[model samples]
Target: MVNTRDLRVIAVLISLLFTAFFVLIILFRGEIDTAATATVESYGLVAIFLGVFLLELLPQYISPHLLVINAIFLGFHIVPIILVSILGHIFASLLGFHLGKVYGFRLVEKLYSDKTVSKISSGMDRYGRWIVLLSAFLPFPYIPVIFGSLDLTWKNFWIFGIIPRAISFALLGFGLSFLTF
Candidate 1:
């Protein structure tokens, strides 16, 4: 029978999966955009807030246009975008970590226990903090998902998580800002 820990893991998994799908929608412009831009500043702010919430609750970052939204609103400065993404992702990862530790690793192990993931998890643990940085810098599909799947330590997650993600985000912002240059 499923217990509270099982339920917690399930909830987190559901949130992550949902975020993945939402990221796809954002990537493909699948959502209706008719009233998106014309909407008031408050609407835009609300959207950003929601995006941040998703990042906190899920493992997808920069995938669902979170970085882009920040870049758009805060201007194309690499610093702000990087800072925001790093902080956002760090917090998200930490939240997941605490949940896993408090609830127990059994739930995470059960959910993410595919053959390939087994190998990935081992490698991730072996590499330790470095993995966080790499995951942060690398492109999507694997990074965030793996982090949540593995149920890493919050402290390690923040240290390794912040550097690469924040830097990559800065790079994106600067690149976009320089488009006219």
Candidate 2:
């Protein structure tokens, strides 16, 4: 069985790994965006699906919204972009939720600063399911792990989290179209 020391070690390692990822993202934002845009242009919706899936499944890489926006600027229809993104995001969120259920928040807690954790936990405690909705609608990370770790019901997660996420994407697609390229 893993002892407290072992768990702490694992948490530290995870923290380091995520920190490295965040640093890379900051350092290579332009290159990553160009490469991501090239991939979507080359592969089309398939690239968007995979990119969104992987980004959502893992933490601290990149936001899938960027990919969707890239697709928009690339002249792909908003409908397909929203549809593909929602599908990819929902699947990833479900898997992340299950991962939370299996693993709990101990390891995940290491991923964020203490203040961020407090915000997430407090928002969850005070607002309950609405936290999921807000997270979905806003630019907040769709961290199903936190929701699942907090023992949110699947129905609530779907209704408050998944659905609103889809709606937000739809809104983004439509709303962004109004802006000049």
Candidate 3:
């Protein structure tokens, strides 16, 4: 359904968006960090939930890891932070899944080389749910796109994607909680 022209246009748009995000971060690093920290402190868990949700929805567009670490440093408990982070990831995955369903192939092609997409597709077929579970914990942000492109069922996505993502977040939260300075 997607053509080369459409893929090129989407790729350009995505690249521009990332460039703009990086530019903003570079230009406003101090102010952004201070504002983010203050906002989390003032609003508490709601801020964390919303922040993580947006980060997950956009993935590498922003660093949610720093946000969560900052939230923990600002005195949010690990349990609630983990819960909210997982919830955000689930919601983000749902969005990505649907997006992939509609435009998975084109997006994947734009994001990865044709050979890479082929390899991933073959691996998904061979590994099935296990791949989904494993991908949940991986740092790679393309997992949801791959799953959606494969047309993976909702049940498998929730089970494999959400569960491992929650566990990973819990571990990350617990580990980060112990850091000093």
Task: Report, for every candidate in turn, its global Cα lDDT versus the true structure.
Answer: 0.53, 0.75, 0.69
State the lDDT at 115 in candidate 3: 56
TM per prediction: 0.56, 0.72, 0.64
Put down candidate 3 lDDT per residue, 69-112, tens digits, no spaces.
66565556788888877777778778877877889788866655
Superposing all C-alpha atoms, what RMSD in Å does each candidate have to the true structure? Answer: 7.1, 6.6, 5.8
Better of 2 and 3 by lDDT: 2
Best by TM-score: 2
What order do you get sorting by TM-score, best first? 2, 3, 1
What lDDT would candidate 1 get against the real structure?
0.53
Q: Which candidate is the best by lDDT?
A: 2
lDDT of 2: 0.75
Compose the digit string of candidate 2's lDDT tens values, residues 1-181.
Answer: 2354665676578657756755665566667667766665568888778878887776533467777766675567788888999899889999988887778778567554455557778899999889889888776767887778888999999999988888887888888887624
TM-score, cand. 1 vs. native? 0.56
Instruction: Locate the minimum summed-lDDT window of 10 residues in model 3.
Output: 57-66
